[model samples]
Target: MQSFRERLQAFNKCVCDGARLMVGQGDYGTYVAHIAKTHPDQAPMTEREFFRNRENARFGVGNSSGFRCC
Candidate 1:
């Protein structure tokens, strides 16, 4: 039996996660969970590294021109 506060917190997390997905962002905590569950022998990246990798993936690698054009 979950307490009211716990239920509310879970609901809040779901809402926030949905909004984040709508904005093309990945949750670091979810990434950690996946790595833990699927690859017990592997290590997950730190939060900063995760975001940097995500950014690089989304915007392509920067070039000598200093900008990424689609």
Candidate 2:
């Protein structure tokens, strides 16, 4: 049986995960934790770098330069 605090934390995490899914922004913490767990000897990127890398990887570019018809 989980304690009240533990249950509440789980519920909160579920809600947050759902909200992130709806908004299309992923949970960075999960990725960070994964890196820490799977590659204990490697250093993880800072939060800003993580998000920038994710954006670039997903979109292939950071800005609208490629979309310009000029």
Using lDDT as the measure, the top candidate is 1
TM per prediction? 0.65, 0.55
Name the regions of candidate 1 deviating beyond 4 angstroms: 62-70
Q: After superposition, how far is residue 19 of candidate 2 from its true place, in Å?
A: 4.9
Q: Model 2: per-residue lDDT, tens digit, 1-70?
A: 9999999999999999988656545678987899999999999888888777755655546466553222
* lDDT of candidate 1 over 1-70, digit per residue (tens): 9999999999999999998666556899999999999999999999999888877755666655554544
What lDDT score belongs to each candidate, Candidate 1 first? Answer: 0.83, 0.76
Residue 35's lDDT within candidate 2 is 92
* Model 1, global lDDT: 0.83
